[model samples]
Target: MKQARLHFYAELKDFIAPNGQNKTIVHNFKHRTSIKDVIESYNVPHPEIDLIIVNNVSVDFNYIVQNSDDIHVHPANASIKQINIAPLRHLSPQVSGEPRFVVDVNLGRLARYLRLLGFDSLYCNNFDDKTIAEISSITQRIVLTRDRKLLHRKIINHGYFVRVETPKIQVREVLARFNMYSFFKPLTRCTFCNGKLKQTEKQNIAQRLKPLTKKHYEKFLVCSDCNHIYWQGSHSIRVARLIREFSKTDSPLS
Candidate 1:
């Protein structure tokens, strides 16, 4: 069996097995192999990779693997000064102005969290990768997902790999990555429907409100798209607490 030497740098190492991490990894290969396939075989998604080097020379994903090759895989956000070589498909610049997203089904909770934070997040439980890819390209929404393969779609211009599994931590991961915490507008959007929340008179939506809600809450934000009403009720207290906790948690800026 022919063999190649490999190493993954920075957060890219998170995708591989423990044995393959933090050091040179030896991979045995048969027949011809592309660098992309070889890297994905180790479970690292191609879109998350910034650069690949073989035998100390920069190469692209389609570069065919050769026996006795020395490979280096760097994270998508690696500093050019660090590697002195650009990674293929550089993680696109975070779009200026408001950030929008087309999220995959597996990240439903993260989608809602992003919506609550006032980002325009569009997520459907049945969204296929092709639809997500098209929507991302046309609407310029960032593709947020745990699925590495979705980000690998060639049509995608801006996308992110949500590294954390927990919803709260995932929210933090996104905020820190895009520097979006400064823009959070709590309850400004409908968390369920992803529609702009509008201010409404208590009497207007009173028919839909519970007696307790009508009696207790004065101000409300109604969803223009879904007509869902939001108020600073008990849930708001919990939401506020969660926001405070996230703000206080030490997040590593990506």
Candidate 2:
């Protein structure tokens, strides 16, 4: 067996086993093993990895592990200096501009929360893994999910595993990871159907509003797809608080 030293940086350490955090791990391997396999074998999933440096040079996941190789791993979203290493496949064709996301079956609430914050989030609880992968590849949407297996798929190039359970925390996590504060446009989309919202005259949606809603509100936004109506009412303050909290917190990328 051949042996090499592995070092994980930033949030990637969270996936490191209890006794192994922050230390160079000497791993024994046989045959020709890809760095992707080696990393995942040590519990860091490929999707969470952005850049890998073998020796002093940067390399992608497919670089084969060699005896005595010193591997330095960086998180996909870590705030670090630009390096010459080729990013893992999932990091491209470059994460600039406003990024769209595809939420998996378990993240319907997260998908809604993301939409509430103006990110273009697509979601369907019925979307199987294959469908989600296809959509992400075709539309170049980043796949967001709580499932590590989904992120492991070869078809998925851009993806993230949401670490937290609460929807608000997850929102902060995503915002921080993607550096999406500039794109945040609260209440721009229908939280229920992932549809764009248009300002509709009160009278146009008058029949749809409840007596209290019609009595109190002068204007509304209607969903383009389902015509769901929105008004600033009881939940407005909560939404405002969420925006404030996310604006201030530099949530961890894990």
lDDT per residue, candidate 1, 1-254, as tens digits?
A: 99999988888878778876877889998899888888888777766776787876788778999999999888765775755544444434547877888999999998898887788999999999999999998988889988888876767868888887888888888887777867878778888989999999998988999999899889988999998888888777789877676665474322
Deviation from truth (RMSD, Å), model 2: 3.3
TM-score of model 2 vs. true structure: 0.85
Q: Where is model 1 poorest over a 10-residue stretch in terms of lDDT?
A: 85-94
Kindly report which residue stretches of model 2 are placed more than 4 angstroms away from their true locations once superposed.
79-93, 250-254
| Alpha-carbon TM-score of each model against the true structure | 0.82, 0.85
Please report the candidate that would top TM-score against the real structure.
2
lDDT of 2 by residue, 1-254 (tens): 78999999988887788799968899898889898888888767677777778887778777899999998888865665566554433343468899899999998878888898888999987999999999998988999988777877777888888888988778888888888888878889988988999998888878878899899889788899998888889989988877677677644322
**On a 0 to 100 scale, what is the lDDT of residue 95 in model 1?**
73
* Residue 216 in candidate 2, Cα distance off native in Å: 3.5
How high is the CA lDDT of each candidate model? Answer: 0.82, 0.83
Clashes of 1: 2
> By TM-score, how accurate is candidate 1?
0.82
